[model samples]
Target chain A: MARAKKPKLAVWKFASCDGCQLSLLDCEDELLAVAANVDIAHFPEATRAVIAGPYDLSLVEGSITTPDDAERIHKIRRRSKRLITIGACATAGGIQALRNFARIDDYINYVYARPEYIDTLAKSTPIHDHVWVDFELRGCPIDRFQLVEVINAFLNERRPNIPRYSQCVECKRSGAVCVMVSRGTLCLGPVTQAGCGNLCPPLGRGCYGCFGPMEAPNTMSLAGWFREKDTSADAVRDLFRTFNAGAAPFRKESEAHEQR
Target chain B: MKPAGSTDPLPAIIDKGGLQVLIDALIGGGFTVIAPRLTDGVIALDTITSVDHLPAGATDEQEAGYYRVHDGGGGRLFDYATTPQGWKRYLYPPEERLWQAKREGAGFAIVEERAPVPRYAFLGVRACDLRAIGILDAVFDHGRSAEPRYVARRDQALIIGVNCTRAGSTCFCTSMGTGPAVGTGADLVLTEFGDDAAPALLVEARSPAGRKVFARLGGRQAAAEDIEAADAAVAKAATMVTRHMATDAAAILKRNLEHREWAKVAQRCLGCANCTLVCPTCFCGSVEDTTDLTGATAARWRRWDSCFTSDFSYIHGGSIRRSGASRYRQWMTHKLSHWWQQFGSSGCVGCGRCITWCPVGIDITEQVRRIKDSEGGPH
Candidate 1:
């Protein structure tokens, strides 16, 4: 469907690092072109200038951590024609979702002086868990190039060219030597979705799975290999329990090792 | 040194020092000299201007899902087996812009990409890689619709093939009928001996361009003993490769379409597309057309793609190969069975790159053998 003459684009935040929103501002040159095509109606990160809703497109960042965020997402979803979630926070509940596995009351008492004053949910959840999300752009602080592509795709009414395969494809394409194979480093590249331009492998380190689990990830198979390499069950559990811990595949995999 | 005009006949012997002379002449001839260099803990093909740039005395031990570089290899430059990357990176790049368009008054003006192609002199190309290049040649340079970008680069490229003295654990070139020795398509071929021997190279000029570069070296004619040593070194490499691919792989794979082994292998396959990306002959690419935010300018780009992805088989309804089992079957079947029908040759060059680079070490050779053994045939 053709959008308005100049679609009103809104950027919304919940509970996040704000790095994913900064990625849009980090678009540097492309941001200017994006502004010319769409009305930046509400982007608190870039500007305080607010244009009232019924926004054509809304770029949502962060997870639903508080009671207010859980209720606020429903109202935002109703006002926007299309909504896309950006980064690990909005897509997989971010690193904060580690609390989902444990008692939040203990954490509140441990950190905050008065536990009675704290107002939060038991579990941090992705935007899709609260409201319908059109698309989810993955990454810890979503890839800026992909952010531009997602916006461009929405503007042109086309599917965004984001790959659902593992990061190994990008690693091999960039001619980066397989760090796991060469150095025996425990890598999440085989199960992590392709994007982030293969940031870690070439630098002699393993992928922390910032982009989250790839489509139909065989996490048990990879964790089995990790165990074969003498990686402790606890270490294997901690590996999957990272930035994309709340992602289903990673969450299920991490929970499997918890009993051990 | 002899003058550049002097004609040196085929089959000459040159010490290790003469290699530097060859590299110098190729660079002076205005060609980007690419050779095997140690980079990122693996032997990679990159631009080198001198002999010292080669991964001398360094050899890598390779197996399924393993690779490690070790020092103290008798100081032989071409001692290493296959490099992590092939010459396809230079000939058919991973990504290239096809064309661009700009918004005009009422219509858009299409602009053709006119980037200059560089003439390359590829040093230390292995037999498997040379065959891989030939396979790519059929796919891109001499196919129904020849790719202009590949043609422009391949036509002007210089190939310097090197005979392997030692094969890696993953190597199966002999079974594929591709190598261990330089066979065809190279302008110049060199067979190197270890330090215990003369520590020299038996060089042969296979083409006129090879002779032109050979003449500049002014090397002595190779003696009969030197040729014998070179032949012995190549023969030893053939013996080094313990792994073998069944010669009738195409027939075996075509017959076992519904083999149970596919599902078993898919469990470990990861469907990561690493095997396809690391493969030299696995030439599949996808085109993406993108526009600036303002929609004022648009460009088309072709980048490497693999069959292992769900998107690769996505049609109007949905992806054809949805399961990992189906995708794995498609990749193997296409590589062995379909490739023979489409191109007159087998797609795999027995380079073992797919096996070596796979994260899970899902061996293609072992997988083929399992399928072959299931029929209870004496393969």
Candidate 2:
């Protein structure tokens, strides 16, 4: 029997850390197995060998923070069949999305001595905001096991099993006592999505909302409890102003707290 | 005070040696004993073959949204507080494959994924956790579709409940009418007490299996003084718990449907779902069917799901409960009120996992108080 042609997998980056793409490279044990299954098309972080698109699976990292990034994503989307966005930046507009709340121009003027040279957009956005996204893997840096799962699911034409539930579930599974319950520490595990495998809770620290809000998150009730701890409204606002601040639910909640 | 559970057959004195004998009996008879072990700086429930594997000298300090473990310097075994991992993890895992389908020739063949549930003899289960398992049992058993895996795992598992001699700062199982003492839903319940020099356990067997296991250990029959000591320990635990749910929970949650407290909470909530996930009895979940990109093979699996997510209530025409207020209201109301009508008991065992795991320290008792205060409900 003739061997079937392998699907070309391309990884692209935009205006953030290369962590998500590095997550793919970090799959050391599985990298060889993954390479055998698919063609490494245009992962600049891994190799300079670039294969032209019309690729099968395109994994996108980082947020669309620049005007060039906004236009480039559409072209990438057009050339790919299944385009999956990875990490907080590509799925929910990353930490840089804080600009969505404040003025980006002010940041450009303050950071860059030559303010006229800046080519960034007013607001950082996810790939889905500009172009169609087949799937979005939510995380700050993204989970490696999930990255493998997502690729495997897509290659098999199956829906990804990445849960939309909160990190509290993961915390329980991993056997980390509730930092909130045990130490009176503030954690974001309750309403945040599960992907990181209860990382922050085991360390006796709270989840910083790295995976974004879970399904139908009830932030109002949780925030009221936060206020009970003598936390001011500004502190509450800053809490929501995190890795996934531009995500709609988080953004809306932050905006609501801003009024106070 | 309120009808404390009656532990029959009286208790037997099981010193350190007797406990080891009991562990040896379980191990020899094909039971995988699981106990709390200090791993990665946390006291986690992990596999143990010997009594020596149990966490010793370590004590946990727990508060709202916070937990810390410090060495208390020797002797007692079950001296720690609650673990982040619960029995639900073993019985109803975070991820379990349901079935898989593959393309072969003209038609696709499907295969059901099955694995034999292990016989686990759980050591150091707190009263709240034991009650939680009971609540979970009712949920899985009473549902139209019983979780066969949960049923199998639960039925085969042996429970060893540990009475709380010292409560964590966040503990309130006493207030919820759940704990502070080893009561029900276990094969054996042990109350740790006596002088530090002669550390002892007052062991009570709830079932025939428990008695058989206990009898094999060759422990001396407990005297009246041992029972008295156990009672004193329970009484001390009940009074020691400082955290209390001051409000009438059911009444407050039921009446405050559209309270302003919901809005205030939503602002800081972040809807993280930690509370529900940490909760021992929260059994809500969703399934997913997946395959590689080729459309060649497909597999279905179930994972734990929480109502605190935006996608939890999502339908074809967007989300049913879009606002954070509605999601928060749904979770608390369901846990406190809806669970009673659905099952025969409240979903919460008041393990305080939700409060401790909550990154922002969103105390469940505090939220209930707010609702109670806003409506001027009974204290």
Q: What are the candidates' interface root-mean-square deviations?
A: 3.1, 4.5
lDDT of 2 by residue, A1-260 (tens): 11278889999999779998999999888677678788999998999999998999999999998888888998999999989999999999999999898888789988999999888889999899998898899898999989988987766655567877677767765566666655566666776888886778787788899999886566766666677878788888888889999989788877878963
Give the per-residue lDDT of model 2 (tens digit) for B110-131.
9877787899999889999998
For all candidates in order, the CA lDDT equals 0.89, 0.81
Give fnat of each prediction, in order: 0.63, 0.72
Across all candidates, the chain A TM-score values are 0.97, 0.96
Summing lDDT over every window of 10 consecutive residues in candidate 2 chain B, give the lowest-scoring window.
B1-10
Task: Give me the overall lDDT of model 2.
Answer: 0.81
Candidate achieving the largest lDDT: 1
Quantify how close model 2 is to the true structure by its C-alpha RMSD in Å.
Answer: 5.0
State TM-scores per candidate.
0.96, 0.80
Window of ten residues with lowest summed lDDT in model 2 chain A: A173-182
